[model samples]
Target: MNIQNFSVASLLAVITLSGSPLFAKEQTQAPAYEYGMPLDIAQAVRIDEPKSTVCEVGQATMTYVDTHGQIRHVTFLQQTDACAIQ
Candidate 1:
């Protein structure tokens, strides 16, 4: 009986792990950034913003890799265009 129970438990574990998202073929998108949200960034990948001659408020995007090695991007408002000249 004990051997049979062990076998059942092992089988269940295998099934659960197989169906888990960790083993999933599809990758889900990361959550959008918010105020005071902590980000575990491993490395930056890219940045998207408008090009202008003067400072302006525009939509900006920052692409980076999280600590889990997953690629993610955050979109927010930022000052784009050329740098301020002294």
Candidate 2:
């Protein structure tokens, strides 16, 4: 009945409506690929092999589609003395 009480009630109603799911924002999905582990060798499309000083140090690149159907590039590196001549 009081003016002050009526104002407080209106403010509370506004806050509640704003917090409801109908007014909430949508969320985006995360990408399927990230750094760290190597991608599946079978799915990769060999792209390039940059020059290296020796056979022991080799580097190659490839591309493939992730589970999300997004294209991704990956680099492979090898560093070992196995290729060195005795």
Candidate 3:
């Protein structure tokens, strides 16, 4: 039926449009910081900590400028803020 064809076309169109951004959102991933990794941060540009109310561990990210003025980001795991308040 024509209605079935239209529904299929609409579904395909919606799927195609929604799928593009998921790939674009993954532009680049930051380097994960490990224990004993030497860090010499010059100026911290921004810090994005996980936003959660649960008292659990989460991943946090920080953007900083190195001594050479190169912008970089690093990811690390830390306890959420909810744990600190308790």
User: Pick by lDDT: which candidate is best?
Assistant: 3
lDDT, candidate 3, 1-86, per-residue tens: 99999999999999999999977755678889999998879999998999888889899999999999988789999899999888
lDDT of 2 by residue, 1-86 (tens): 59999999999999898888644432222223345764644465455655544556565555766666755666566553445543
Worst 10 residues of 2 by lDDT: 24-33
Report, for all candidates in order, the number of backbone clashes: 0, 0, 0
Candidate 2 regions with alpha-carbon error over 4 angstroms: 1-42, 79-86
Model 1 Cα lDDT, one tens digit per residue, 1-86: 99999999999999898899765534554355689988878999998886777867777778899999997777777776566551
TM-score per model over all chains: 0.54, 0.36, 0.65
Clashing pairs in 1: none
The 10-residue segment of model 3 with minimum total lDDT is 22-31
Q: Which is superior by TM-score, 1 or 3? A: 3
Candidate 1 Cα errors over 4 Å, as ranges? 1-32
User: What lDDT would each prediction earn against the true structure?
Assistant: 0.78, 0.59, 0.90
TM value for model 1? 0.54
lDDT of 1 at 74: 79
